[model samples]
Target: MNSDRAAANDVDVDLGRLFGSLRRHWLGMLLFALISAALVFLLAAAATPKFRAETRVLIEQRETVFTRPQGEEAAVPAALDAEAIASQAEIMASAPILTKVARDFDLASLDEFDTSEPSFVEQFLTIIGMKADPIAVTPEEAVLASFREKLEIYRVENARVIVISFSSEDPRLAAAIPNAIADAYLENQRDARQQSNADATEWLEPEIADLRERVREVEERVARYRAESDLLIGQNNTVLATQQLSEISSELSRARAARAAAEADAQAARRALNGGGSLDTLPDVLESGLVERLRERQVDLQAQIADLSTTLLGNHPRIRALQSQLSDLDAQIGSEIRKIITGLETRAETARQREEDLTAEVNRLKAESARADEEQVELRALEREAAAQRELLESYLTRYREASARRDRDLLPVDARIFSRAIVPQEAYFPKVLPLTIAAFVAALLVGAIVLLLRELFSGRAMRPAYAHGETEAPSAASAKTGTAKPAAASPELPPAPRPLDMEPAAQVPTTPAGLTALDIEKAADRLVANGVTRALFISPEGDEAAAAAVLVAREIADTGLRVLLLDLTSTGAASRPMLETSSYAGITNILAAEAQFADIIHADLYSDCHVIPIGTADPARALSGIDRLPLIMNSLTTAYEIVLVECGVTDAAGIERLADDNTQIFVSLIDPEDEAIEETAEALKEEGFGSPVLVSPVGHEPETVPPGRTVA
Candidate 1:
């Protein structure tokens, strides 16, 4: 790719090839330039002009400004919780917060906003009957929301600043949109805080009610349980036990009196007459004795009755049988004296055992009663403490409720201030029209460059300037000889001018298919009736200017002393050296317009009686302007000279047609090896409306045989 580019640059300065190509395609470039420039100009004029405006909003580091004595002052936050406050600026751009700004400002309508050519909008408005053309082309609704959409905010890189920007057709509106959005953001923040407070209050109402219900339910259950279980002091069972025991003691005294009467007379005959009366007609239960014996007998009977259980109850058959036996025995004895003696034995032991057991049972009952009372008192105290705690909690909960209810109605955000102002910037804040246009144009140029380059490459054109010049020039070696005379040297000072023609006709020319020698040129001239060539244009293949001049000089000696025109038909004019003899001469380029006239421009040195037209030093513009008319211009010059010779130097095929008319014989010149390729160039000319070429000027080291087959007429 780089080599190809270098090759293209090489084509630029080669005057011959450049002129040729210019001569060929001059009309194309003109057409291209005119057509392109027109289309571009119209496209530019048809575009709508857009205007822009802007505003900047700096995100503050803190809500409150801080002052310091020396270093930079830090901003103080209104929030005691500084971290939450610091996050506000970042949150301003976050979706949750910015989304709120969008919603509050009602930004949904801007989705179809058109910022293209503004002229289209005027027609659209006129059709809708909304406005008097351009003056009133505004949306009927959702304007604020649309404006918020146009607004954009960004934190500046590595700076404590945020840039708020907006775009619109109207510059004032562009600025207004951002300011309105910033206000919306600030207002939204305040309302968001209030909303948060309302939500918290809403939740606490239900929680407070539930806590109260739970506390009341527990208190009610405690009260019901205590009342059902008889939770009072002296009315319980242990306290009533003593009165029942006293009633049982009165019944025992009555039983003792009955037994004493039965024992008064016993069976007195049965008694041994010493100590007591013995029962005779009525026997006593205590036969030998008194009341003590009668009571023991009655207790023995009671003890037997005690052994009888509930299966018999009081009316059991065995108990009744025993009762009958006891009655008969009482009858048979007919004395209470025996029963009283039996009662005496039982009375003392039973009373002592009953008293001991009653004492122990009373002591146990008193101890249990005391412990139970103590437990009840402690439980009551705990219950009271818990109730007091619950009451205190209820008081706090009530306070919380009041605070929430009041705060919900009147709450305000503590740190609400403008984090950034509604700034209207002096510079553009709207569509950014100029910068956008410039960017579009630059992008267009880059794309166009790529397109042009690819087009040139894909066309398969040769791109190398070196190829255009054929090859780099190496200084040619002079034809060396064995016995050649030392050529006449010019004097140190300038030599005297010769007559009109000073050529040696007798110089040996070589005639070979390879090229002409000096003697051969002389013979050729002799055949043409002594210097017979009239006006002639001599041409050669690429890189053959030196050989072309050698042939033209040979022609100058032939055919009536020809006058010559040797055109340096290259872009860079590299073939001028061979045309110079003693001092330099004026050239064909000098005859061009805005330069010297044709007669004055053509130089005639004293080299020969024959005159020569040297190749020109004209650039493309100068050459094409007047040299384009060169043939018509040259008609006047035929009167001054008899024969003409032109050194048609190495050149491209661009202007070959100029030398191809009936008045001119195009002599194709070549060197030995590359001369074979000259046929192809001839074919190209033929295709461009040129016929057969008069072959000449094939140079070699020495005179050689002219090959018949190789020579073409």
Candidate 2:
């Protein structure tokens, strides 16, 4: 096993054989690599060095004052995103931009751009059918082609920056071309914008003029219609028809009130004159001077007559005179009352006449107002049309002024702007000389290495294992019957096996020519149980098939009510096979990384009593690097299960040695009967104190039935 440990450590590096191969072929391999590198370096130095220069442009959506509403800042389109910037880059590389750049630089006249005559070498190549002759083209086309070939326009990812790059043999030309392209693109955008505005102005001018005429015509029609209908406007912007109607109604009401008052006064005067009450109570009678004077005279006469009657006889002249005066005064007073009553009647009659006149005027106005109302409706409709036309004309005029002003002032807005100018390049962008040379050298060395390996393989000089004592010899056939057969010398370590005391000496389970049989699996399980081996790790010299065999044995052991757990420690999960697909947990990685609990990683439902912990999320190398905990994990698993079977896939002696203990049984599964390395591998394991190795070969026949007395439940 010390030899096995030595072999395992040397597994990663084939230093001895590699150095021997180098010793034999160093001069030839080094010469080949150096020559190849030197040739590549020379070619790189000879190639034309192209200087690349780039100019950055920013695409901004510009805003103009004319486009914005009053009292607000101008509203531009949304900011340019990556896609918009890319569009600007395409415009910079477009045919128009290239043509303008070419014209400005007079590129068509340069030999680099327009080579009219073919060189002698090119002519010879064309005649020999190795190359085609150059096609004839106009100077413009030639210039365009040459410009495009050197130009590269692209946008930065996820940004609004556009880069215009140009590659040329001359550094100054490369720098100058990118700047020129950027300038041309900006100029092109300005020209296009100005042209659009100019076109807009051209279209707007006539439309504004026509709208103005329409407005005038409609307004004139409204005026003429108003005059013909005689409809007028009044204070408060109200139509005269409505105003007149309102005034007439008010006047008629006032006139009726006056007439009624006059009638009431007249009736009161008549009642007073007829002796219904005192004439003084009547305002008309009291206001008369003649009536008042007559009353006073009557009072004086009555007093004088009373005095004369007392002083003289009834026939006295003085008494008769006072009596006559009193009679005259009374007649005058009565006449005055009659006159007051007659004046009241005349006032009432005048009021009635005035009311009749006002009523007739009111009725005439009402008819006129109704007629005017119908006419005003038509007049308002015409006015609205005229007003709409005037507004439209004003709007067009404003737009026309703006467009024309922009065209005249040449203040066109351009969205693309150059922000970074290209400078003269100090170095060539092409060739990448040093890197190319190094890569060529490495590639040549790799080829040499491959050749060396092939030679070693064909020459049969590859390293062979050296075993202790007679361990290198092949084991006899009888050893296979005992299940302790030493496998052929395949590796320095013999495959570890279970002790013979674990199994009864039963008839041999025949070996399959290629694959495993059920009898072989059962015998392995029986031996494990007999030896009280709760923890066993299985390995194979020739990998995959043995992993499958381990799975069969684990499943068979589990069916017998022995709690069996199959730990798929294989890198490829070949041991767990179809069972590995049922779970997502990492088998050894989970345990090593401590990412999953034991219960989380274990899937007990996979096979009747068999628990399987699959390889989990951690990478294989990371898991394997943390294998110091493997012993502890195995110990814990042994306590939980009656049989913990580990399918150790293609592991070295050191890996197996780490897990092997006094009570642990290790089985080496083999498929090929005549593998020459088995004996050596077996001897190495034996020396490592892993006990005699068991060689379980698959026989290509149906699995033997369970032993008569020991059928699995």
Candidate 3:
């Protein structure tokens, strides 16, 4: 408990001593700070102030009504993004726009922008070869360059609005430049649109005339084809030949039915005559009436013969006459039947002849219909082609009319409009004297603080009282404070090796005990180089005091032109407080978390070529998360720097395990040679493959002042 309290008191005393040093030199620090701030104020007052003016233009997707056909909407382009906005900015800042503005304003003659007349100072410097003479260029080019340099263009967030800014020594010129640029931009847009419309008209006129001639030609060709093919359309749009074929087919069918009926009648008549049946059944035989009469006469003759034969003898004259009449009647009936057969044959022959004539006509009409149908197919194809051409020609005429309207009216809508015009600024936008002066004061105060602190540190009187008093303590008293303060075993005597890499001799040690003095730090750097120890850890048995030793040693090594980095692993400002102080915690933990880049977090230290990475308020748990990456980080640092000195403070097994490698050098600070705590630490490091540790005496005492009873490693 007393040890913990004592450690806390030591921390308070360390902080108090630092503040006390600043307080003791307050007047000198204040004087230096005032002088620096005053110098900054004088320089700032001499600079010329520049006023800025801006104009806002809105860019949109739009087209004139005359350019588009009726019922057709204007095409909207794709949505604008960062690249499109930047493209617009480039256009506004282009040489053409700047040249136009310069020519109109006669900016070539202005003293502020004229490059032909170099300043007296520049001319003198050029003569001495300290500066180069201005390049010879046309006045137009010189003015354009000056105009572009002062011009600024940016887009409004989430909108298609462009803001053009111009800066100049004269407020009126600043205002005039942006407004002139905007007007020129609008003019360019108008001219571009007009040119496009004129081009459309130029191309469309010839095309429309060609289409009109083509329409007329196609119509005439269609009429000529119809006439030549003889494709006269009838009902249902059929050809006349096809209609004739249809009529002939119907008449032929009727004629065939009539012929069949006649043939059937003729066949019945012939059958009656050949079979010797009664002719009365045949229509032709009945119509004649001769057979009926013959039959009636025969019946009369038979009755007379029968009556006569009853009274008269055989071979009588009356009987003979009656018999002859009967025979004659039969002959007459046969004759009549023959005549009827002849008439039926004639009728059948007439029907067959009629059927043959109709069939021939139908066959001829069918051939004509086939020819007409084949021609009609070609005729329809031509008609379709003409129809399509007519449609296309009509469309072209419509578009041509719209283009003509646009060209004649000479009206074209600009895509952008000046929504806000620039006004003359009342005050300059740069070299704000008040804020700069205040900033200069703050900067100077920090610098003065650093100067005062460095002066106090070098004077050797700002160290803690313990550094001088503790050296006089007996071995028993030192042993109580440091648990391992017992005497150590002596090693074999060896000659001191020459310093490595031609290191300069170290300066004499200062009489201070806060940690290693400037001279001791230089010696440590020399020893580290001699041993070829690129990676080293400096720790105190108590942990808090070793940070200053590490920082000093790294700084001294950096002074020798070796790149060195001091890593402060302790959360307390032990390693970095003396050289730099920052509130934001960004270091290895940030690198491990991928939250920040190394360049963003790494800060330059007070000494030359020395960089320090403070443990900044990183969460201990988060920092520990990167424990496994410590070796990789150290290795990377070694490649970047000649030496990386880590202030491990009172070393933990976790800290040592992560940072230790085969060639690592371990240096420990000991207030007394026999401090038990430091000896135990050395033994632990050796067990962890660090080999034997190098012992460094605390500040305020030389190595020769140690008692003979004590052993130094």
lDDT values of the candidates? 0.46, 0.70, 0.69
2 or 3, greater by TM-score: 2
State, as a TM-score between 0 and 1, how close model 3 is to the true structure: 0.48
Worst lDDT run of 10 residues, candidate 1, spans 474-483
RMSD of each: 23.6, 21.3, 20.4
Q: Which ten residues in a row have the lowest lDDT in candidate 2?
A: 704-713
The parts of candidate 1 lying over 4 Å away from their true place are 1-150, 156-163, 167-171, 222-409, 414-416, 429-713
Residues 1-713 of candidate 3 have per-residue lDDT tens digits of 23321321121124555567688678877788788778878888888999999999988855666455576666655534667766777788778877888889989888888888778997898789886456755677767767777988888888889999999999999999999999998887788777887888788788878888888888898889989988888888789999988888988898898889889888888787678776677776666767677778878888888989999865898788778887888888787778778877887889899899999998898888899989988888888988988888888778777767766786566767898999999999887887888898888888888865664444322332231133432122123234433322231132222212111222333233332232355577898867767788877675565455676677667655444678887657567665443436467667665566666456555223467777765566876777777778788777666578888878644567777676777777554444567667777776766666766543542222223222110
Q: Rank by TM-score, descending? A: 2, 3, 1
* lDDT winner, 1 or 2: 2
Where is model 3 more than 4 Å wrong at Cα? 1-15, 64-67, 70-75, 79-85, 119-133, 233-366, 384-389, 451-713
Ranked by lDDT from best down, the candidates are 2, 3, 1
| Worst ten in a row by lDDT for model 3 | 494-503
Residue 199, model 2: Cα distance from true site in angstroms: 2.2
